[model samples]
Each structure stands twice: as structure tokens, then as C-alpha cells.
Target: MSDELTAKLDRIPDPKTGKGLQAAGRLDGVAVRNGVATIVLKVEPDEAIDRLKADIESAAREVDEVDRVQIITTLQRPAGGGRDKAAPRQASAAAPRPARQIIAVAAGKGGVGKSTVAANLAAALAKAGQRVAVLDADIHGPSIPRLFGLRDIKGLRKTDTGIEPADAHGVRVVSMGFLTKPGQPVVWRGPMIQGAIQQFLNETYWGDPDVLIIDMPPGTGDAQLAIAQTVSIDGAVIACTPQDLALDDARKAIAMFEKTHTPILGLIENMSVFLCPHCGEPSEIFGHGGTRAEAEAIGVPFLGEIPLTIELRERSDTGRPVAFDDGPVADAFARAAMAMLDSAREARKPAPEIVFSS
Candidate 1:
């Protein structure tokens, strides 16, 4: 069993360095019992984990004697680096609301239009006959309410089992702003911030929806950590622009998610281009396709680019997301959403045959 499994594991290659697993000492463990093979791999964090796992399993199963194979993969983290352990993760919601998927939209820093992208993405998904819910996890600076032009909304309401979420433009909305006074600042400690996020996630009464989009706050902070331990996140979408400053932060955001072991759906290049109204000429305002290039470098898909336009801002500010109307900006968001849908489905694909059903 050992010799056969070793031969099989050594035949595979590392996705990043193009070196065989045996050469890199990545195939750390292999055992076979009762026709089942268990293999362990210690690879770099940036390596294509899903592809590598599938490849390793396929090779092991080809051994003829092995009936089933299980691959356990762990990232090779740098020395002195460990995962953030600030917040205590809550158990899965006891109620088990029927949300098919939850995708967190995050950025390295603020002002990257992360919230706007999440809002418009949810709007686009809803327009495509998907029941969508948008949770403004940006507790400190919640723009989800303002993005949908719900300026007058004071807060959410208490309910018998859970808190009720607001409905805006046919999308479910929930934010910390609903509980605080207008313009009031949320200057709390780490525990307070985590508590707020916990309530929003576990206590909200979100009906069955096809997708639940979380508009995460900028930077990797307590909120991000809280979400990591709270529930099982389906995937993440990193939002960034073409500017170097923004990309620098975007890299940090990506690293944080990697450390947390969350699958990244892809990166969205917001403000990819700017259109001049008078001359109808396009300008590389933020630099063209920087996010696409970054995505390729990081091995994630370049979902789509959203050109900078005033109509998007105006409609978003007026409680009408551009995705609600048919146009260029709306089409861009729809394309981006479609990319996510595809990536998510592929990522969540079930193994060839399941021994147990959930």
C-alpha cells in the first residue's frame, strides 16, 4: 500500500513551481487501508488548491488497487505567521434559513466602491430572477442604505424569532446604520464590533433566497475575522481599481482570505475606465485592466470590468441601482454576476460520488 501510494503521489506536479511533489517534499503522508487511500499535501498558500487536489486524487485513483482517495491539503505558512484569532465563531444558525450561497465582497481599504459593487451585484442578481439579500457588514460606515436611496430608514425592527431586514428595490437590506442615529459614529472596541456582526448574521430573519451578498467593510479587521469564524462562507470577491495604492491593499485583502482558507471567487475591477460625456471618448483613468492582470498573477479569474460612469453614482444615490435599468453599466454588473455564479457553482461541485447526504 505504501509503495503504490508513494508512486502515485510522486507522479503529480506542484501547480506553482512546476516541480514534482516528491521533489518538493509536498507529499507528506500517504496510507492505504481497505482499498481507501489517504494522502496529505503541504503546498504553498498561493498554489491552485482545488486543481491540485483534483489532480492528486485522480492520480491516486488510477493506481487500480485504490477504490477511494481522500486528499488533505494544508498551506505552508511563513514562519511566525498564524491565523487571526480575535473573535469566537458562532455555530451555524439554528434556524437554517435557506440561502443557497453567501459571497463576501471585500477590499483592502475604504473608498474602493466595495459596497457599490455589492449593491449593484445583488441588484443584478435579483433582476435575473434570483432572490438576493445584501447584508451591510460594514458596520462603521454602512453605505448599503444610502446606495439604495433609503436615507430615511431609521433602523431594523425586532421580531418574534429574529430581527426583520429592510426591503429596498426588491433586495433585502440590513445594516448597522439602522440602529444608530444619522451621522453617529461607531467607535467601539473589537468585541463590540464582533457582537454587532454576530447579531446581524444569526438574528436576521432572511427568508429563503438564492444568494446572500455580504458587503464587507474595508481592510482586514475584527469584522472580517468575525465573519470567518461565524458561518461557512461560500466564497469571496475582492474589489479593487487599477491604481497601485488600491492594488497594494487588495493584495493584503487576498492574503487575509487565504489565511482564513476561504475560496476566492474572483476579483472585480471597478472603475476600469472612464467615459467622457462630451466627446464620448474613453480614458484609462485608473489604468486599464489592472485588476485583470492582478487576477491572472494571483491565479484567480478576472470576472469583469465596470467602467466609471456618473449614471451609476446618481442612480445608486437616488435609491435606484443602475442594474435595475438596462444600459452599459448595468450590463457590466450583470456579466460580473454571471461570472460569480459560474465560479461558485464550479467551486461547490460535489465529488463524483457521495457516501453520505447532507
Candidate 2:
């Protein structure tokens, strides 16, 4: 049955490439179950998404066994290879948002719990009565959707104002994860990444939140450059583990923000230690105080340290941030959030003018 549907879909033309859907590689997958057909389509941004979806749905319904048709659309990587010469966009071209403060949470490399920190921080802020929005700009490795328990969201609604963000626990959420399937890889180029960031900032109606936390992708790469140059970032909070290798990358992240002139609010040391739940023994698994030491060396405030524990991981996996409830981890994140707010606002203050004696 699925094969028959695929053959039918193959006859439909893809608007972007001017070829049959299958020939253009637009038909990603087709499955039939319980008299319902599920079709996955890879789409380009400028293509007519609705028209293509309608065409495919109409064709799928013609099959005798298919009682309903559901189309899942995922973004395709932009065209162009190594020869492309376009430079990164300037800050003047960026679309502005109404959020009072924009904070970027970054990690020098992957596996550093950057997304976890960002989500918990947003939750903590929201719990404190501040309107918060989180833009999961991780692109290729967007985990904000899952951390917030919104993994099932496949798309967003477009109104006269802009794209509507998904709300979870009082925080407005926007992420590339919502558009793509679970475990699906985003193979976009650098230019595509920058463009997506612009769209998220410009097209999403963030509703004048008090704080906008951008969950930055691991490493100082295209996404980082895009956010730095595309918007007036109030400050950046760096997340890193307590290890030599992680610290090496953390330094690079700090340098990137410095070069971009984005204020470094502070450094957060995640996974500082592991406390045995049963025995209550503390273990410095990654070696402790590395991030604080680095923060002191760089003249930036050390926000706080997050201890590694089974509860923290369990809460993150189950779509409940530990910070939402009252616990030791929650307390630590709350403190970090308070420090970040203070540091960011202070950094935003204008330099005092010096008057020399005439």
C-alpha cells in the first residue's frame, strides 16, 4: 500500500525543483497504517508549502486503502557549495524584537549541557514573574523543544503579526526542532543557518516578553555569528563543564563574544560534581572549580556551579526542568539566573563620563 502511494506521489511535481516529487528528493518518506497515510516532505523556504501539501494530500486520498492523509514538512538545506562567496550579514539588517533583554546561552562544544542550562534558566525566570521566551538557535542540535516537553509540535501558525511561538510552562518557545522530525539532521549551510536565525527573530511574534533567552548551539560557529551580528544581544552566559578540554573551548566562546562586543554576563560550570543519591557521597567526576577559576582569570563574574546528579538528568529527559521545582539544583539555577540578570543590566549601563579639572 505504501509503495502504491509512493508511486502516486512520484507523479506530482515539486514546485522548487520543477521535477516529480520523488525525483526532486522532496518525498522523504511514505507510510500507511490503519487506513491512514503519512507522508514526509522536504521543503525549501520559498516554495509553496500549502499548495504542495494539498496536492500530495489529494493524490494520497485517491488510494483505496488510505482513509486520511497527514503531511509532515521538513526544511531542506539551501543550495550552493564551497564556492559561495556571500559574507555574514551585518547588525543593521537584523529584525528587532520587543523583549527588554536578549541573553544568549552558549557552550564552546557539545555534550556540555548548554540547552539544559538555558531551559532551566528560562523556567526560573518565568517562575519569578518575568515573561520569558527561548529561541533555540542550536539549528542542527536543537534540544529545547524536548527539554520543555514540546517534542510533538510539528509546525507553527502564522498570523498577521508573525509566527506564533509554542508556549510551555509560561515560556514562549521557538526551535528548529519543532519543524523537523525527531533525530532528523539539519544539513543546512552557514548562509541558511544565518537566514533561519533572522527569520526566527523577525517572523516570530514574541509578545513583548521581559526576557528572551537564546539557546545557542554548541561552539562559536555560524549560528553564533548570526545572533551576534543580527540582533542587539544584551549579554551572553557561557556554560562549560569542569575539565581541561571543555575549558579550552570555553575560552574560545568567551573570545568570540568579546570580539563581537557582546557583554559576557558570567560563566556557569555545569556538571561540577556528582552526588550519589543513595550514599550521599560527593564525587568531583569532572574535576571541580575549573569554570570558576576560568571566570576569575578572565575578569568575568562566576555565576554558579550545577552539580551532576541523577535527578537533574531524569528531570531533563522527562521534559520537566529541575529548576521548576524546589530542590538543590533548582536553587543553584535560581541563583545563576539572579546573577545573570544583575550582570546583564549592569553591563548595559552607559559608561560614566570623566570630567578632568580645567
Q: What is the lDDT of residue 164 in candidate 1?
A: 88
Largest TM-score belongs to which candidate? Answer: 2
On residues 193-225, what C-alpha lDDT tens digit does candidate 2 reach at each position?
766776788778999999999999998788887
Q: Whole-model lDDT for model 1 versus the true structure? A: 0.82
Pairs with backbone N, CA or C atoms under 3 Å apart (clashes), candidate 1: 148-319, 149-319, 155-178
Worst 10 residues of 2 by lDDT: 83-92
Score each candidate by Cα lDDT.
0.82, 0.86
The runs of at least 3 residues in candidate 1 whose Cα sits more than 4 Å from the true structure, single-residue gaps closed, are 1-90, 93-98, 350-358
Cα deviation at 355, candidate 1, in Å, is: 16
Give a tens-digit lDDT track for model 1, residues 309-328: 88887887788889889988
- How does each model score on TM-score? 0.73, 0.76
